[model samples]
Target: MNRRTFILGGLGTLGVLAGGGVLFTQRPEFGRLPRGERLARLEASPHYVNGKFQNLVPVQVMNDQNGENRFVAMAKFLFGDKSHLSPKQVMLSKKTDLQTLNPAEDVVVWLGHSSFFMQLGGYRILIDPVFSPYASPLFFINKAFPGSNVYTAEEMPKIDVLAISHDHWDHLDYPTIMALKPKVKQIVCPLGVGEYFESWGFAREKLHEEDWETEIKLADDLSVHVLPSQHFSGRFLTPNPTLWCGFAFVTPQRKVYYTGDGGYGEHFKAIGQKFGGFDMMLGENGQYNMAWHAIHMLPEETAQAAEDAGAKQLLPAHGGKFALSRHPWQEPYRELTKASRDKNYKLVTPEIGQLAYIDGQKNEQFGPWWENME
Candidate 1:
């Protein structure tokens, strides 16, 4: 071979090796959990053996049409000179004394995005906690709020339960989980997600896997029911390696529904029928676009979802943390407020770290918090 040809071929081979190294090392080894005994117990379930409901599908790329789905143009329209858009601000709550938060009653605090802290029946549960600065694989490229995390890991109380709705990076953060492992007593998650915790050093015994429609009694008065969500999941290139579902927290004082992240579907009606009525429904209201309508619901659909779930009050989530969609940061709130006004549904828009008491008749209004920041 000529010297120049040989040099070019060698360079190509090196490039290939470099690309493979980045792909393998950057991605977490999610399936390396101790599989023998755990797989035995998991295989006993019919869903596991048949792969009836759990399967990973390849993601399809779409052709961009005009400005219809161009994220850059949409972002420019929402925030002039995208680079000039202000960073998100974190609202720190006044120090919460656990003694003051009565566990005999019901209380909720929204920590931006879909993360929430709830106290009921003497149990403290955190749902989909993402305390990391960025949700993207490349941390520096994606920015979070400038201040400290709204709530630090050290500040958290000894948690009774940590419930995960899915395996999306924004919903399940690796840094936060490692920090919280020592303090968390048990983790209740859907089918494939428990494997992630097992690989991350959480005791296998502490992880409980529940399929759709299964109920686990946490305490005499507190129970969690895994309900269907019209959604898919994946952290790597492959999608939906496991199942995705919402959670219903049934306490003696109230019924709270955490609609993790889902599109509008008939399942909401089924949940209403099974659980009767919910005191408050926390549903996703942001990170939506026309291209992925079937995967993420629009603002109007969120209000409709609240009604379908038979919720007396609605609290929109999945916004105010990261810029996951083309819409302006405040667009969801603006549209949802109008929808709530037209439909006569009570909407709760809490500031970051604001406490919301479920039993109280007077609900607090925090913002348009995302508005002024922009």
Candidate 2:
């Protein structure tokens, strides 16, 4: 669901839709589009222009300047050699008991790919959670690698804030969201994304939707800021209807930035300067290609972005779960290990479900666990 066709593919693929007809539209996984007052609020936002929400710097979904086209990209994805795209063995991971964690401690647990469980300022925050086995509407597409889905919604602790970056199938999964709805106390999403939660029976008051650059003060010590990211959003046929964003979790003592999914841009430096630099940065460093480099970043760009954000520690995400792109599954880790050598920030690569403490002077020491896991 990270690619252009995957986003535009809708719930069903072309073959699946060719047979299902209009009944495919009835599926709840497709999610409801913004309408009524919600649509009006989206239209009023400065980011929304013409008919769609645009990035701060105008971005093309595909980089046609690199001699890439949609059809060519689609062909490469569908027919490309994918031998190394997924690990032959199950992914190595930890089984940390999230519920047993101390409330006073601040920590981050990456739930494979872009989903994360973080405890900051004594508040439990879950971002872009996809506990389901698949990232697509269908079970066959974008399936999670073996042993990658170590945590489930039922096992999750009571969530203080469930922040969603976008409406892409991988990030805003319908089944996962429905399962975690009752456990989540409050929901934070980009503009117009509240429509899906409303349609899913969540109370309007529970949803806090904000446009880019707006900050929602949750507590005296903690404030979640909706920031800019160079990405697009869509779960169905229509693209960029809802806003896509990055998030900055700020507290009096610590600061963390999560780049939901984006290419490198000045916004990284802007965010770093805005917050006086971050203690840690969780940015996307996988599922990228030259075909869509304008949207998703490469490993080298990820390192540079981390430096631009002045991050003390950089935790590379958006891999170790699914093969959304044709590159070797562990390429991001290997490339980033080298790319971050001369960078200011320490590149912290933890196994799925392992803890990355954010409160102290010392962080967990992790090795290249993906090295021999073919």
Candidate 3:
């Protein structure tokens, strides 16, 4: 084909792909914010600014001094070294049957990469469940590596509380949410997150949308505090219309903290001081790049955050499932294991689906399971 014809054909193909992406985002699974009262509540939040949500401290999404455009940076990351990016063999997991587990046992199980199933204070809580194979509007993008997906929607029992940290596509999965609706008794998410659930036909009463520093009494035995995470939120066309946050699950005796997804910031110290300390802290321990230093934390930073949170033991999540960054999938594990050495908190590295007792086992023996996976 002539150069002119080839260029024309390429442009046409690009147009078609872009159009398909636009339509894909419009699917009901993508979800939308509520208007009227819900919108008013969102606008009233301290984090909500003139038109968008803001982090506790200023965040620089990129630190590009070399004037590299976003498209160029994105392309480089998209096509980075394939050999170190994902495991040749899928990572391993240890199964813990959620349906049969004792709810009174106060155990926590990692469902891979920012997802958790915990029975604390006689309450069953599921956090950021992304059981779907991919973490994108388009199924082909951000596909989970083989063997990473062992638990499915069918294995989950009726959840006492579903704690969603933000509206990110990976975290607020539509297919997973729809599947869990029958089992989710109540959902407590950041301000503006309920709109998405309400759009999906979740009862307005069941949706407890909270702003930063606000306390939510999920039950007589459980109280959840919505706290700040230096992160942004959105799913489809719009961005940051919803607030992103961390959480402190307070029971009569124990406090469990979850750093949803965020960069290392002073908010961690502030939260630590506010709550005194966490018995078990779940930190976001993967998907980091210097390009977006203000959003995600590096492994060293993860260790620091654990110390700042005054955690008795730090249980790392946000890894083991998805390779959302350019780094090797197991890099976070290797780095965090080294960084947490002699730190204030014990670094707890349980294999995905293994039992992590929040209140029962404060000193669970952890080893680098991903050592040979790469």
Candidate 4:
């Protein structure tokens, strides 16, 4: 072959090899795979069927005119000239340990984002426990904050229930579940999420899947009622193959609402009517935008959600840990605080690893510690 032709051929071969390497490294199989057929069948079952879209009854939220501008400015400030943003820096106080939690009382400790350690009536329940650093499909691509996870899987107490809101990677970590399986008693999940756990070696009998608006009694005076949420679900390309909803936990002492991951909807009022009133309502207050308003609620909508659920006080979650959207990391809190002040809603902004005790009549404030991080 001529010298020029040989050089061109060699360059082409190198380019092909480079492309192949990139594809192989980024493939989904390198991460967690979808559930198997047995699990898929269960997830696809009609018992967990969600009604038509009309049944959800979506609520309208007023747009923030300057939201986009603020988002761009904050993005530039935090991630200047970078294509991807790094995780925020966080400092954790070791005042209360998750391992030393009392299983007989009503208490909650924030692990990060939507993950929480909740103890009620001698039962320990964990909600959406994401211990991994990143919330992405590829672990190496995204990163979590350094020294953030206060309690590792090994440090968790004997868990009576592991409750999942959906199958999002940020909410469901495969490695964390495998490590926690030995100590977990039973997993209570929305419609299709149990399939993911069962494929990861969790026993079928240990998995309890509940449909929307269904109620199950876990123990004496401790019951879980699945409520409607305006959210979609999927771990793969198939959307809504499973279901997603919030949960209401009722105890003899007090009632608490965990608004899993949802946007604003009228179902909140129905939930309030069905369950009476709650001492505390944990609602989503982060990573929202006008582009996807139907799927995630803005701070104002979160306040409205609290009112609709008949909660005396509100605990804003789904923020303060991971930077999921374009808004400033602290925007959710700022907006929520303002909305609460204007609307006269009682809101609690808890710090990472802080505890909140709920007694029937009195309300208390925990941590605005996230303010220090700003």
Candidate 5:
């Protein structure tokens, strides 16, 4: 080929690549970064340093144990055995008509993964809601198990408070947030996560973006406390621009906690003491591996964390929906059942969309639903 012709072809290819990059960045799913006053607030936070949020204890997102780097871990997860990574048979679930429920009842409906629909203190609240069929940016990746995604944004009643734990795609879904924006009366998220909501046209007055140890009153009877989690946050290349956290909902009569994706840490005990003791603990109990043990907890740790938090009941989250790890689909349930045998807390395993009472523990019997499934 002539030199002039080769140069022209190379330039054309570069132009196309540049155009594609621009389009990719423009997608609404990418969300918006913190800027202007939001960026200033983040910078002032004690947790925010060197342009990123820091965990209470230093944590490695991917720990290199036994000479295994992140690439080796990824390769094993993608091309390894995976014989039991996904269930061969459809999982079991029960659908509850959320709008038809009595407003005076205090209950929790598991919506799969880290998503939940909870009515506490006579106010409806949603936590880390990912209603989309998949958890990742691409539809084909991290797809939810069959019969697991039974609830959608349309099925949810008007939300009194929408609480987001972080900015990861699984916890803060773009499409789901957009669909539920009209029904959400208020939004509570960790520092800097509100940038995404403001960019999507949610009113700034509705956002209660806060830092760790801060409390926001949602109603006269209910208050939401932003707590700590040993986890990292990021949607794309940059990590920790937004903070990751847990939530403790305190009413006049009861207190409940949600441990948003975190590994074993002493913060659990600290939070437990601060709140006295929780009535129930919604712990992240799946998608864990030794390679990333610094970020995600094993099933045994999930139980121990609840114990440290002085919880009487523990409901597992971050599983029963998408397969994001290499373990068997039902391993978390089996392991947690064994782990909770000697612990002080009772293990609560409810099917997707099934109601689990948060108030006095009536109708708390949930069978091992993950069993008998392929």
Candidate 6:
């Protein structure tokens, strides 16, 4: 089979059947995990309960809260409210070249969706980058909005650290990871997430799979803290076998929080208390639905989460690239802007590929670039 076809079927590590059964084939393309010593370690982890990882707090998936599918409710959430679901024209964005930027300058480039390229303390960091046209098991579904997929891996500089929150296809593209592996020096992710990277030919030594609240010191001035989040993980069928989380990027120069993808929870307030405060928070503000409200937060909740996290500035993420849910493509920015009213935090709304100066996180310099566009 072709590589795409292999990815669709031979989900060796994460491929799940429509039923609850998980497909654990020996197909090398599927990227196996937990072999030999790794399996022994996984069996001993306290978080790995009943053959899968359990969240600190139980989370409801796309199905009904009881784990049963109510077809009427599911159908409405998925298919209803098609109006203004996406823009008619390609979204315009600023052109950015990472190789041309000054390494000493701390800045961040939002490459659509949850993808971010950040330069801090002479280190280049990438988080949850998916530069593909479609985010799906098949070729046709979840096609990204026009023009949002312009930032390719070729445009990226040598990555000092690649941070992955989970292994979902939308956040972890097979082809994109393959393209980026050579340039990436270190990989940071939730525990068990590096198994996929190791299977994909990454050196074991370069992979740093961290548990919640654990810290990885990068340089004399920089460190990363893996923090807890309320989210589930699975590429295909084996649910929660791997962990999902957010992260706190700590440097002598700045403190940044990245909420990779998750619903609103008290953990936001707790994370803030632990970190003291964040200069900026990269928040998930899209791809939400009431049916699966326990996994993704609504726009107002996204605003509140930033406030709860004690972020001085809110960087809207997980939107403007793909319509993973039924909401209008621009709804996230619109609602987040409104919800932020009278709130303490400043909203940082940069277009895709626009630069977010680390120093500017505290300044109200960015405008609503999403306004008056398609």
Give Cα-based local distance difference scores for all models: 0.75, 0.90, 0.87, 0.73, 0.91, 0.83
Using TM-score as the yardstick, the better of models 2 and 4 is 2
Candidate 1 residues 1-374, lDDT tens each? Answer: 99999999999999999998767655663333325665555566544435323422222222244655556645544555444322545443433554467666678888778888888667899999888888755665345655425777767888998999988878888888888888999888987788888778788778877888899787798799987787777776554556688999997778999998877878888899999979888889998866666668899999988988888888889987676666777789889988887564578887777777776575666556555565
lDDT of 2 by residue, 1-374 (tens): 47876866774586676768657766888878999999999999999999899999997887663576788887777688878999999889987899999988889998999999999989999999999898987777788998999999999999999999999988999999999988999999999999999989999999889999999998899899999999998886898999999999998878999999988899999998888888899989999987788889999999999999989999988999988888899899999999999999988888999988875365767899999698
Point out the worst 10-residue segment of candidate 2 by lDDT: 7-16
What would the TM-score be for candidate 5 when compared with the true structure? Answer: 0.96
Q: Which portions of model 5 miss their true places by more than 4 Å?
A: 2-15, 79-81
Query: Model 3 — TM-score against the truth?
Result: 0.93
lDDT of 3 at 337: 89
Tens-digit lDDT track of model 3 for 3-88: 99999999999999999987877789878765788889888877778878998887876677357776777777677566677788
As for model 1, its CA RMSD to the true structure in angstroms is 4.2
Candidate 1 residue 200 Cα shift, in angstroms, is: 0.8
Q: What TM-scores do the predictions have? A: 0.84, 0.93, 0.93, 0.80, 0.96, 0.88
lDDT of 5 by residue, 254-308 (tens): 8999999999999998998999889999999999988889889999999999999
Q: Candidate 4, clashing residue pairs?
A: none
Query: Best by TM-score, which number?
Result: 5
Which pairs clash inside model 5?
none
* Lowest lDDT 10-residue stretch of candidate 5: 356-365
**Residue 241's lDDT in candidate 5:** 92
Per-candidate RMSD, Å: 4.2, 6.2, 2.7, 5.2, 1.7, 6.5
